[model samples]
Target: MSPPARARPLSKAAFSPTFSKLKTSIYTDSLRPSAPVSSAHFIRTLSWNAPGTLIATGAADRTLRIWNPEKTNVKNSTELRGHTGGVERVAFHPVNETELASCSSDGMVRFWDVRSKAVVGEVKVGGEPFTLAWTPDGSEIVAGRKDNNLIPISRSTLTTITEHHQPVQTNQCVFTWDGSAIFLTNGDGCVKILRYPSFEHFYTLNAHTSSCYALSISPSGGYLAIGGGDALVSLWDTQEWMCVRTLDKIEGPVKSVDFSFDGSYVVGGSDEDNKLHIAHTETGEYVYTIDTIHPAAYVAWHPCRYVLAYSAEAQGLKIRSTMDVQAPLNPSTLFSVRGLLVVITGGGTSIGLAIASALHQNGASKIYLLGRRIATLEKAVETLKSSSSAPHYVDVLINNAGVIGPRNGIELHESESISQLRGAMLKDWSGWESTMAINTQSVFGVSAAFLPLLEAENIRRHWQGSKVTGYGNARHHSASALEKIGTDADDSRLAHIITVASIASYIRRCAAGLVDNASKGAAAHIGNMLSTLLAEWGIRSNVGRPWNENNIGGLILFLVGNGGTYISGTVQVSDGGRLGVFPSMY
Candidate 1:
């Protein structure tokens, strides 16, 4: 629970002195001042192009300045004006650097063409604007108002199309990868998502114990990083709409966080200590710290470069590179394959639903979910589709139907009458038969019905990778195998078959003199047999061995992602490794 070492504050004199000396020694002969300008009124936000060649800053001076940071005598090349009040935040169009959006205290958000320094359009909300976000397509802009409402503005018409209501003051807001939704953090320690265009409440995430301030989505938008008054940064899985991990005991309230373009490193800024801290996104391990006395307003990781940009009071804008440092590689960058179809059965249980979510956040193109209950399946599907990126990918199917049944038997006990036993038998028979029918048989029916759609995806991957070795053939093999099964193939195209088997499958209970009853052990035998059988077709099957409700989802996630890619043909047993040492005699 110790605070990250990178959260320490830096002295202004010390940082600038070293930076100045380094600058003087490296380019002393070429260094020159570009006609000393007036003191900056109030610096708000800073941004850089993907290449780190150009820099942009929004200031209270009512001017947006674009600069060439590479030159020693860097000078402002263009000054943008349109905002009537102090520009509080600025974000560059991800794909087009020539365009950018600025939010001001005037309750107006203006989109500008940086190259022309012309105001393309403006969106007026009701209150002071605190934050602005652009969709992945750059087609829409989301503005966060002081009253905690989020307004989605169309980039074309510059008019508000949707507004999200927050019960508390909204500190920040941003869109998911595909830009179909907006994630907003309130000062009341809550984060919620709203579907774009429709403005429907998607999911409400409660993680922090204090006010939530800043929020940043990983490059893939699979994980969300939140900083708040609690002085901690928590990572949440977008799929399950729940908190996965929390990095605690920081020096101060985090004001901002930026994930590396590759999704490996996370850099955060603290308001209390006025310092910048870096950590590994996956493990939450502290990396390093940059000392700065003045509170940092914003931080950004260059999309394709090693440089990181931040605004410091003493230093107008500072750039640092991890190129020379041996930093841990980013896990988010490892698997960049987009548009893969993943199907999940048993989506009603916490674990099954969690796996589907983790896959979606990690960049899976489509998710096919199966379960028996219509209500649960509908809720899960709605949660996934609410994300902006969800529409681009398809939800092939979510079967929320299941049944369980007895192989054969009718027994009477001394404590119950024949009629009572009959009633119990009827209920158990109905439940068991229904469970197996939906959990096992229905899965086959749905997969069979969706085989053609899955095969079509395979062909697309084949065509996309025709020039690459092994890719086209791999896709073809997958497609042909999936098609041949025609939904009846119980053991094919099972990229990840997550079974929520009960611990009772392994534990032996001798209560009521029912000693050594081997029938209850059938589930374990069936799971093992199915796993071994499925391995032949490249499908991996693993069971979620959760000992408690809390760990159910995590165990399922471990088996589905890269961590479980090599783990096939075996029951995962998610009892946190305790099951390994426990003695099981049956």
Candidate 2:
């Protein structure tokens, strides 16, 4: 017999990435308020429907969410709930647009009709089914469990046809594009190839040092990518099952891996926070790194496009695009607060009201006024809402309420005796207690109360929560391609708090009394302190004093907008050149 020909080498230029820059324009869907925002539902797996118009996600919260990527509002997503345990993996049928399947720790592989949002059929494979895949012809399904069993079921019968017991626990499994072979990764760091239907093992390749966790095959059926606990992705040429390249540099075990639609690049989801590593297929060089706030657990590329969908542990699903179609830097994005929800104390009048008006005009999603007077707060909301269209959610909190304590203004000769002066100040000494409580104490109280809401906002934006310390490792990525992206999707800013203190806090000369100055001063200090205290929670705090009521509003608008991301735990003074005129401390 004639000798078989050897496979040709892969061309590096042919498999190079199409785009180097990427952006995240789509926001993740929000969970219902009934789920405590403090405890997030971690999304472990996801899949794209055949047509690529819809996405299916399985979360630890035991619920499924179907999302339309074109929609701008996250609230437009639809949710399905039925699983009793954490969902592990989800896969859409290869040929059916409306059919989807998922496996869960609940011990069942359920098939759903996405059109009706109902489970049409289920196979109780038992054990904790951790991963699932549909056959290329859509005639069968296979599920792998933690108990080292692989069960195959006939699609028509909806029952397990047989079970294959493995020597080691299987972490992931997939059918080859031709449906002639099955590739499964096991706990002993090996990728086993099995012949279809006959259940005979065909080949075994040593793939990783630690347990193998993730597996993916390219669209062209020419390459296979295997991710393992060693934090590396091994790329193999399918023709001869030869290891062509190894992608390293990930910081943790690769939990999920996927190939781009064109098979030019591969992405790895690591167990470490903020690590979504993408590398080139031909050269095996690092191409991009997506900074997620939580450990990235699952990743899937769109069937027809370069768009990528991924899940952050307990944070939910996010969609990012690698197409360079984002807009450039503009004034509207820098100064606008288009989607921020704001809470302003004493928002009914003067400086507080002006700040509210600026936020309203600039595009704040909602303005919440906090005050004892119902009529005044209602009037402020009506005025703000009357002129604009926005939603209700809190992203920024403003502390702007205060009382002038005991107006004890007296001249040197105004009082004849020391007793007269002392009595004048002591007459209304009772007001001091109330002033301190309302002004200084309330700053901390209100900020503490709104913490969950603030952290929730950060989560909604897909930003990792609570790391107020110095930039740490994140600072090294500041100059990365993420900042060069032209879209708003690159925003990783935290939730903000704006505390309105007075010039009295700094100036030795008091506009009112020592008590008023002391309270405002204390409030200012609390604002600064809260920045450090709450940095761990992903909340930012800033103090603003209104030198010119007009300027204070604009300053606050800037603070809440995209431009103010770096101005946390600091003071924003809007004196309108008053500091230059006065001999007071700044």
TM-score of each: 0.50, 0.52
Q: Could you tell me which 10 consecutive residues in candidate 2 have the lowest summed lDDT?
A: 1-10
Candidate maximizing lDDT: 2
Candidate 1 lDDT over residue span 449-561, tens digit each: 55444434423322111211111011112111222323211111224444555544565532222211232344445555655654433344555556664565455445544
Backbone clash numbers for all candidates listed: 26, 3
Off by over 4 Å in 1: 1-40, 50-53, 322-586
Cα displacement (angstroms), candidate 2, residue 428, comes to: 99
Colliding residue pairs in candidate 2: 42-314, 293-464, 466-536
Q: For each candidate in the order shown, give its overall lDDT on alpha carbons.
A: 0.58, 0.75
Give the least accurate 10-residue stretch of model 1, judged by summed lDDT.
1-10
